[model samples]
Target: MKLKGIHHVSAITGTAAGNVDFYTKVLGMRLVKKTVNQDDTSVYHLFYGDERGNPGTELTFFEFPNAWRSRPGTSSISSVSLRVPGDAALNYWHHRFVQYEVDHDDITERAGRLTLAFRDPEGQRLMLVSDEHDTGIAGGKPWVKADVPAEYGIVGLGPVQLTVSRAERTERVLTQLMGYTKKGQYASAIAGQPDIVVYETGEGGSGTEIHLEERSDLPQERQGIGAVHHVAFRVDDEAELRAWIDRVGAAGLAHSGFVDRFYFKSLYFREASGILFELATDGPGFDTDESLDALGESLALPPFLEPHRARIEAGLRPIGTGSPS
Candidate 1:
């Protein structure tokens, strides 16, 4: 079975309120889910995505207040990229960033695509890459309440870049087991970075491209705010997910087995580079527990966590208001 694309990328954030304000108000993505992390029920697990909270569009964060700064090095996801429409959209975003007083760099070319690099309030690196092939207006569905007009808003998630100690191991896992093909490579896209090998999967839409940059000299990364927890790839259904589990076994890669996350089933494993990767099924999506209009309006818990909902809610801090309706 072929892997579909990225389901979501989870990262750590310092403050829930700051994260909510920036992602919703400044970035223009809809906060699709407001929930608690099942594994760690004390903090909030916030989700942001396109209008429908589509699998490829999801970008989630775990609230880790008082967390230290992430130590950047090899074997880490250094940046998350989003897809914008094109040059016009990029220009619009340039102006939007300036208007909102967001810290960002001017447009630049990377692997033949125009990009605007920036960081979140908590120092999470991000970029807006222009997809020349995309015909959809400003990438994809837009959140109606976003400050930027729908046409100029972000389409969805694009390529994610990883810093690895060595590309050989990770490259083998991606090409052989993950149903990905090497698309191209870029030399020195970022200063001090060596060649970056681009791997694409499943017809290659927004979240299909992954760049592996080998930096054997860099040290291992430490966990903190702005650190990426894991990068989850997508499988179409339970059957396909099972097929992947078999594939993982055949490849001799250790996995966490099937996990029921309510919205999706997950199989998490670390790649050769030590960057955590997850194979997540795409069925029974975010809307299963809540209606489209009222999603992220209240806290949601899985069946197991439902019993302690009151206790969990009490421990978590309140999410700020004035978010996208």
Candidate 2:
């Protein structure tokens, strides 16, 4: 079974309220799920996506209140890209970022596509890639009620960049163990470095790519706020995910097998370079527990966590009211 494109990318955020404001109010993605981190029930896990929280569209965060800013280096998920409709959409977002005082670079080309690089208030590295010439895996429809016009709204996730010290080791895992095909290479933004390699999985396109940058120049990253925790790739269903679990095991890689994350099933593993990767199913999505109109209005808990809802709610500071103090 071939792995689909990206499922979601989970990152760290210092404050749930501010994260909510930036992603929802500024970026205009729908706050599709307000929940607690399953592994650590006390903290908030917020998910932003297209209207229905489709598989490739989700961008999630695990809140660690007052966390330190991340120290960027090698062996990290360096940058996360969001897909926009066209070149005109890139121009629209450039003006929007300026108006909102968002820190951003001028629109530039990367891998034959126009892109706009920027950071969140907490310095999360992000790029908006234009899909004007894309013809592979399709992007999701933007949330209709978002402040940004639908035509220019962020649709889904694009290529995720992995910065690692040992690119060959990670490349082996991707091509040999994980079934990603080496697509091509592109020039690195950093001067005098080797070209960044590109890999793609099922239905190759922007959404299915992993841009790998090999750097001998930086130390290991210390993850805190604004750093990506892991990136997950999409699986068609539970059966396909189960097959993948077996495949990962056959490769002798240590993994968390058959994790039933109520919204989806998952298998987590790290490549040779220590970057976290997850294979996640696409079904039993966000709307399974909540109706479409009421998503993210209140905290959601899986069936197992329902018993401790009161205790969990007591620990979290309220979000969406205003900025956290």
Candidate 3:
């Protein structure tokens, strides 16, 4: 079975309010889900995406107050990228970033596409790539309240850059185990910057890439605020997920087998260079709990956590976005 594309990228954040403001107000993504981290109920697990909170559209964060800041180096997801519609969309974002005083770089081309790079308030590195040819995961509706019009709104995920100690083992895991095919290669325009090797899903665009940058001399990355914890890849269903479970078991890789995430089923594993990866299914989407119009309006708890909802609600710091519809 072929892996569909990227499901979501989960990262760490220090303040839930900062996460909400930057993602919703500046980036214009809808805060589709406001839930607590299932494993740690006190912290918030915020999900941002296009209108429906579709699988490939998600960029999630776990907000742990007073956490250590992430120090970037090797074996970490260095940056998360989002896909926008075209050159016009890129221009619109450039103006928006300027108006909001968001730190950003001038538009640049990589892999033959225009990109606008920037950072979130929490110091998470992010970019907006103009993918006019990406029809794969472009179907999500834009948020109604977004400052930018729906026509020029951000669509879904783009290529994610991961810094690694060695590229060979990571390349094998991506190709042989994860089903990504090498697409292209480019040396950074800046001297001493590691060469970027592009890998795409079988589908080949939008939310379907793992760009490996080899920095063998750098120290291992430590995860905290502003760090990407894991990258989740999409599979079609349990049938496809089962195929992966079998494959990872046969390969003797460390993996979390079939975790029922309520909204989706998850299978997590780490690559040879210690980059965390997950295989996730696309069914039972974010609409499972809330209606399309009312998503992210209230806190949502999984069934098992329902009994402890009172304690969980009391513990989480209030995220004061007031219905991110």
Best-fitting candidate, scored by lDDT = 2
For residues 1-325, could you state the per-residue lDDT of candidate 1 as single tens digits?
A: 8777777999999899889899989889998898888888998899998887888888999998978999888889988998876778889888878888888998988877888998787788899988776422233487888887887777788889989887889988899878789888888655776798888888775568898888867799987998899999988888888788888888887888888899999888888888899998876988998999977888888788888887887787776654322
Tens-place lDDT per residue, model 2, 245-269, is 8999999999998999999999999
Sum up the clashes in candidate 1. 1
| Residue 81 miss distance in model 1 (angstroms) | 0.6
lDDT of each: 0.84, 0.93, 0.86
Extract clashing residue pairs from model 3: none
Give candidates' CA RMSD values in order.
2.5, 1.7, 1.9
Q: Is candidate 1 or 2 superior in lDDT?
A: 2
Q: Pick the candidate with the highest TM-score.
A: 2
lDDT digits (tens) for residues 1-325 of candidate 3: 7888889999999999888988998888998999989889889999999988998889999988888988889989998899887878999989988899988999988877889999877788999988775545454667878887987887788899989888898999999877789988888664786779998875677578888898856788878998999999989888889889999989889888889888898898899998899999998888888898888889998889989988888787777745321
Residue 32's lDDT within candidate 2 is 94
